[model samples]
Target: MGRSKLDVGEIYMAESKIDARIYSEEEYLALDSDLDVKYEYFDGRVIAMAGAARKHVSITGQAVTALNNQLRDTPCEAGSSDLRVQLEGTRNYLYPDVVVWCEESRWADKADNTLLTPLVLIEVLSASTGHRDGSYKLEIYKQISGLMDYLIVSQNRVYIE
Candidate 1:
């Protein structure tokens, strides 16, 4: 299957106005090989992810570092944005800012890139994505069976929820 092209203008437009093209799980996964950018799959809709700001990147790194430092010598492990987390039995796939999983980690497929079990999911909010991150993504992240906490960190200020 070939990867679908997305219009940058459409992606930055208002949520309701953005043109959404649905793709099957197979087609979505195939995009990994073709696209330079990362996307999040929600149900059958592929949402384009914007590049993180400098503050967003810094906060995410600090969060991951703090979590890893505290989790050292334990079963829990912290991962960065490159880790793709699947929403259990659903077709949804998201790349969180930081993810922490304890005990054995589960992979969605033989490739071992998609993580099925995440204990904690964190998102460092940006101006463009803060609203969706705090609301839409929060709701979806809550569906994970083993998810204990979902955090939304603001890059503009010292806020976390």
Candidate 2:
């Protein structure tokens, strides 16, 4: 789909063009630390986050809960999508739906909200970010040396990768 031209002071619409402001890694982190909404940074551009549907929220909970139950006996721990994972290679700040780690869980900063060493990452797809999630994010996540699995969960039906 072609992107529509963005107007100044206009509300953001999914799939439509916006300010497209590019942010440095440090600047993005500052925003992430204080901002209520999570913005994904890639190649210097900030992607505005969209709200998830109720069904999407439910599926995400189920996926995380199941992963936690399965890993209860092991040292590996499961975290919901709230955790921010920085791609070790590209340095893009990303939030996965479920992050499971058996390795060291280090703090990203003094704030300690971000998890830097997640071994297994899961993403619950939404309509607006499906393309980027499947293509852009998938390629970056695959490069993480410690990441064992990258699961892409579809909200429309029972599907995962």
Candidate 3:
């Protein structure tokens, strides 16, 4: 099946007004071949992800580096934003800014790119995504059984939680 294109907003907002149609998980996965674009699956709706800003990218990189260094010689390891995390048996798939897995890694697929378990997930918030990160994404990430820390860092400020 071909990917569905909807004329949503600028695609930079976290919560977009996609009223065209709700797509199935299979249809959403079929569009994954487009390397330049990323999509987040929420129930039956697919939301297009926008490219990160300069400060957001820098903060994510620094967090990954610092987390890796802090987790060195331990069981946990840091993964970049490309890592896809599944919400266990649910139909949700998201890309966190930085992730740390301490126990055995569980791959959602055979390719080992999708993760099913992670100990810590960090999201570097942007102006357009702050609300979603604090609300929708927060509720979803909390469903993870092994998640101990969920830090939402502000890219333009020094606040984090």
Candidate 4:
């Protein structure tokens, strides 16, 4: 069978309005291939997450470095924002700011990275995405049995959850 079509829904946030969209994973990937910003796909719905600010990138960098150092002598490997973790029985994929996975051989170890089971996942939050990171994404990430921890780092302060 073929994939479903994309549709727009009326989304209201107080005085602000946004268009909620639903598209198949394949359709989203086809669109994402040409876009610059990373997006998250959940059950045929697409949400374009905000890009990391300078401070957000810095914190993510440091976190990835620390995780990499910690796994230097082990089979686990650490990664940053360019990597994606497929979740929900491979129905969805998200590009977390940082990820650590034990299955190194399966990963290509490149910039556009992929991990089967990330023991740890980190997200540097922006103003537009802080709430989703804390609630929606948190709940979904927890569903992965291999995910041990999901860390959320604030862009404005030295806060890490």
The candidate that wins on TM-score is: 3
Candidate RMSDs in Å, in order, are: 6.7, 5.8, 6.5, 6.4
lDDT of 3 by residue, 36-115 (tens): 88887777677777889888898999999999999999988998788888899888888898999875878778877788
lDDT of 3 at 18: 47
Candidate 1 runs further than 4 Å off: 1-19
For model 2, name the residue pairs that clash: none
lDDT of 1 by residue, 1-161 (tens): 32122332233334632236778999888885455778778666777777787878888899899999999999998988888999888877889999998768788888778889899999988777776687667766777887889998877777788
Predicted candidate 4, C-alpha RMSD: 6.4
Candidate 2: where are CA atoms >4 Å away? 1-18
Predictions in order: lDDT: 0.78, 0.70, 0.78, 0.68
User: What's the count of clashing pairs in each model shown?
Assistant: 0, 0, 0, 0
- lDDT for model 1 comes to 0.78
- For residue 60, model 2's alpha carbon misses the true position, in angstroms, by 0.6
The C-alpha local distance difference test score for the whole of candidate 4 amounts to: 0.68
* Consecutive 10-residue window with the lowest summed lDDT within model 4: 6-15
Ranking by TM-score: 3, 1, 2, 4
**lDDT value, residue 123 of candidate 4:** 84
Candidate 3 lowest-lDDT run of ten: 1-10
**Global Cα lDDT for candidate 2:** 0.70
TM-score of each candidate? 0.85, 0.80, 0.85, 0.76
